[model samples]
Target chain A: AQSVTQPDIHITVSEGASLELRCNYSYGATPYLFWYVQSPGQGLQLLLKYFSGDTLVQGIKGFEAEFKRSQSSFNLRKPSVHWSDAAEYFCAVGGANAGGTSYGKLTFGQGTILTVHP
Target chain B: DTAVSQTPKYLVTQMGNDKSIKCEQNLGHDTMYWYKQDSKKFLKIMFSYNNKELIINETVPNRFSPKSPDKAHLNLHINSLELGDSAVYFCASSHPQVRGGYTFGSGTRLTVV
Candidate 1:
């Protein structure tokens, strides 16, 4: 079975400072990785996803994540933090063997709450 | 218009009561899913339906049942609700062809008293 681990439960960063959230997954084969963001009382919004190709994948809202296969990590990063960017973030992994028929059921990590301070 | 919508944004009921949460998607996607977000903010998939057919059913309690009337709608019904069942439930839809990420609803917060 696949699983995801997010090391940080909560993180605080000042505006304009760089931020990185760590995520690691345990899966057998090449996994489909995704990063999602959720505001308070709102559903999750996709930040980015990695199926294959480039190691560094850019996403919405000036966020990006790098897939490091050797380390089993897909950490989300931003060059500078904004107050509006503060939210709960989750990293997920899905099996590739699920194929088109299964539509890729995901195993999500315990979210990391980001707090951006002025 | 909302791409994905879940009715009763908040539901508060006594334990042992039964309740249902309805979800509908307007994106014309063939796949719909139900996810539970616990107090710790951990999201876990509960069930999935494709074209009104059950696809993935997680190891959730039997009290939690999902019914899909069609490809566009999936409803969750919980019986003998417990305090542990109190959490935010999310509905999502996706297009299988593009491998596009899911579009999620605002979520329904169910509180058991």
Candidate 2:
């Protein structure tokens, strides 16, 4: 079984300040990680995904995450956050063997809600 | 056009009244899925269909059923709606290889009153 844990339930950051959301996962096989953002009353939008590549992967809206194997972490980071960045962030992990089917399904963490202040 | 779309974005109905949520994906993906997000924001998979065939069925109750008419549409039908069934239902689609991850719909918020 695979699981993801996001320690922070709520995060507050001022505009123009750097932000980092921590995500940790436990998977027995090769893990495919993903970050998704959701606004209030809206659907989830993919921020980025890590399958197999450079540890640092860049995503839209000036977001990036690094996959740390030894630490079992894939933390999302941004140099500076904007006011519009206030949303709920979710971290998910799944083991996609050679077949690309999630061992069963993707496991998601308790989302972290971001509140960007002026 | 929305790649993945769901109908009845906001549905409010009395308890015990059955309802259905429709989902369609324009993307040429081979797989479609249904997920439920509880009030506390925990997401769990309910069902998954691949190539119009049911592939994954979680421990959901028999009252909750998913119907995939074709490869591009998967609809959720809930019978004897209970208060516990009130939540945001999301529809998603993806290719088998995890190419670009999955595409999600705008979600339908079901309120059982």
Candidate 3:
């Protein structure tokens, strides 16, 4: 089975400060990684996804994540944080199967709560 | 035009009661999924349907049943709900073959008293 772990339970950063959230996954094959953000009482919105390509993938709202196969990590980062960026973030890993039916099934990590200060 | 939408943004009911949540997608995607977000905000896949056929059924309790009337709609029905079943349920749609990311609904918060 595949699983995802997010080391940080909560992170607080001041506006204009850099931020990074850690994520690690355990999967056998090439895994599809994704980052999602969820505000209070709202559904998750996709931040970015990595199937196979450049190690650094850019996403919406000026967020990016790097896929490090050696460390089994896909860490999300932002050069500067904004107050509106405060929300719960989740990292997910998708298993690959021959039939392509497993692509939509995502195993998500325990979310990390991000708090941006003024 | 909402890409994906789920009805009943909040559902509060007593234990042992039955309830259903409806989901619909307008993005013409062929795959739809149901996910549960617990109190701690941990998300887990519960079930998936592709082209109106069941594809992935996680190790969820049998009390939780999913029905897809067509490719565009998937409804979740829980029988004899328990307090443990209280959580936010999300519906999402994606094109599996195209490697596109999922478009998620606003979510339905179910609270069993």
Q: DockQ scores for all the models shown? A: 0.60, 0.58, 0.65
Ordered list by lDDT, greatest first = 3, 2, 1
lDDT of 1 by residue, A1-118 (tens): 8999999999999999999999999987778889999998888999999988999999999999999999999999999999999999999887556443446578899999999999
Question: For model 3, what is the alpha-carbon lDDT of residue B68?
Answer: 99
Q: Where does the lowest 10-residue lDDT sum fall in candidate 2 chain A?
A: A95-104
TM-score of each: 0.95, 0.96, 0.96
Which residue pairs in candidate 3 collide?
none
Candidate 1: clashing pairs of residues: none
The runs of at least 3 residues in candidate 3 whose Cα sits more than 4 Å from the true structure, single-residue gaps closed, are: A98-103
Docking class of 1: medium
All predictions: root-mean-square deviation over Cα? 1.5, 1.4, 1.3
- Tens-place lDDT digits, model 1, residues B1-113: 99999999999999999999999999999989999998888789999888898988999999999999999999999999999999999999887532467889999999999
Cα RMSD over interface residues, candidate 3: 1.9
Candidate 3 local lDDT, B1-113, one digit each (tens): 88898999999999999999999999999999999988888888899999999988999999999999999999999999999999999999988642557889999999999
